[model samples]
Target: MDLNALDDFQLVAAHGGFGRASRASGRSKATLSRRVTELEEALGVRLVERGARSLQLTEAGQQLLARTEGPMYEVADAIAAVREGVATPRGNLRIAAPSLFGQLALGTLVARFRTLYPDVEIEVVADDRRVNLVEEQFDIAIRIDPDPDTALVGRCFARDRLVLAAPPLLAPPSGDLDEVVPVPAVVMPSYREGDIWTLRDRAPRLLPRPVLRLSSLLMVRDAIVAGAGVGLVPQSIIGGQLQRGELVSWGTRGGDVALWVLHTSRRLQSPKVRAFVEFLCDQYPDKAFLASV
Candidate 1:
């Protein structure tokens, strides 16, 4: 099978239709359709179910696209590496990050990076769902306390910990350090019945009485500030609120959580990726900014 035909097929599949793919690649719609047809013929299967107003990929097509997208991106990155050896970073830089970090910190970081390296275009997707870097074609991912994965490699740029926070009026009275205070709490959906919060170094244990359950930490913080209940949130996200006395920290919870900027181990360190990692490391040389963000 011709690689060019396969590439064209992937492009059309990626962009959802031949017309958009044509506009994106500066190739005629007829040419893209012909290429996909040729690819389908070579493979002896129908890849696309073409329609007047829509395009849909067959099961085989979906499988093919999913399997090949990562390798194709790797190939492009390899070509780019050789064409621009140790040169100025130029190209699209796709990033995936946790929603809280993305909202609180990533925008500013991306803006600064862009100002320094004007050639690099950035796209950031902020969601809590763990994305497969290779399958998703992401240049980097910023994860908090990521689990061990042999397929990923990167540096832990910062450390953060969870803190119990609440409005001053609603905060549990500080009477006994060893007492398990039963506080009305705004918690994540993961918090279940009888789940007690153990503070770092054996500080007062919090027996959270769930008053409200939120899906995201941002929402939990808002609820806590609104006096709904005390919340356990990452210190990084609530630094400003804590400093401004909008929310008072009850105490730190558990141990430190490391924040990492990671990339696929299989891919070469493209100039764009290297520059971004370096930019992040330079910004947080002592791993303090993230901890306090």
Candidate 2:
């Protein structure tokens, strides 16, 4: 099969259609259309459905797409590898991480990365929603959950403990979590499912049952500091407050969370992506978060 044609197909899918792909790829629409047609003929399958406005991938096309994408990326990586040898890490590294972390935690790291690698461009996407790595063309994603898929590379950078806390005055006495926890509480959107909260080593507990619920951690932290209900927050975000007496621990304690960095193995092979990942692992010092965990 022709790799250029495959590239065209991938570009079209990425850009949402042939016309858009042509504009993005710097190729004329007619030229890109012909190339895709040639690719379809070579593959002996109708890869894209013809329509007046938009293009959709056929079932066979989607299957082929899945199987070919990894190899296509590998091919690009190999070409880039040869063109730009190891010493300099230069390219766009598209990274996506949890909104709060991206906005608050990564500022310093991002600044240092740019200082160290002036040639590299960092595009950070702050999203609370999960991103589809392949379809979204992201080079790196920092996810808080476990990855069941083995195709992508997933490594735990650090472990963060969840703490139940609130302002010093409002916090209940620390000894027994059961009696102390029922004081009003603030929760993140992701925990809104059953309205039931469960603690490690304890049975599921009911909510509204006692406290207020919130969607954003920023808001939760603000509320907790303002003497609002207790909140369950990552120790990484609240450790300083606990030390300064701005916040105090409440409710149950002791659940550790894995901060996983996810990316395709192909992306790991790229020098730019590899450099950034190594920089994150080495410079970010997971120990600070782990100590509190």
Candidate 3:
């Protein structure tokens, strides 16, 4: 409520007159008088008695000054706190991420974050299972969908494309996942053990090589690199191995999923969380592991 007028009246009382308040506050006496007059008019009460020489506060002004001084100082403190939080990102940031990303690229991401914000501490949990971010107190979670939980705040930064990868020793002449089905092979972090890896965005009859499922994507990749078999896996995790000649992708017909960076409602506002999310958006704008590494 007309805080400028309240402050002007307070200044007038504190320094004894508009002339003295003008000198103290560096505001012109006319401006100070105008603010005080507006305050009194807004309040529907005369807060001060104007005099030729002596200036005196009325009961209303005295009561307001008594009641509002503490609250105004609190407002100032709150504003200062928000400003400081915006300027600096310093805190413990806990993250939950997909096991494959953790094994393949999270190390580099964490290192980059450390270099950029040395004061922030990073803690990460890598698991295929999606955790309750709020219950676990994680600042962020990474997911590849079709996930059921649609409640979190998130941004999709990259696509997790399925690559039909195999080591050169076991490379199929046909260059098709279905053609390699007779060979024993693998992908981990699977929901079920089956030969039917469905191809979407295309004909339902198309399928990947029947995967001999392992427990983790890393194990599946390692088995493939060691010449075990061809299996469908995310391209983000296998880009390095493909480049290094340890593994080669047959290339898939479909089965690409969007990678999301999800965060809790409360931590979404934090400077550290916002900074990391924005950095992820910039760093990944594509498949991050393939793009960066």
lDDT per model vs. reference: 0.87, 0.75, 0.76
Model 3 agreement with the true structure over 1-293: per-residue lDDT tens digits = 68767877888988878999999879999999999999888889998888998798888878988998888778778989889977788889999998777877788998999899998999999987878888888989988873656568878877767777878876454334344234456755553544454444322232345456687776777888887787777777777788899897665746567788888664438889988988888887565433333
Q: Which residue pairs in candidate 3 collide? A: none
Candidate order by lDDT, decreasing, is 1, 3, 2
Better-scoring candidate (TM-score), 2 or 3 = 3
In model 2, which regions exceed 4 Å deviation? 1-83, 171-181, 189-212, 251-254, 266-268, 286-293
Q: Write the per-residue lDDT of candidate 1 for residues 131-191, one digit (tens) a residue.
A: 9898899989999888999989999898888888989887455545667778899999998
**Angstrom error at residue 257, model 1:** 0.5
lDDT, model 3: 0.76
Q: State, as a TM-score between 0 and 1, how close model 3 is to the true structure.
A: 0.69
Q: Which has the greatest TM-score?
A: 3
**99-162, model 2: which lDDT tens digit per residue?**
8777666777777888988888889999978888889999889888665877678567777777
Q: List the residue pairs that clash in candidate 1.
A: none
Worst 10-residue stretch by lDDT in candidate 2? 173-182
TM-score of 1: 0.67
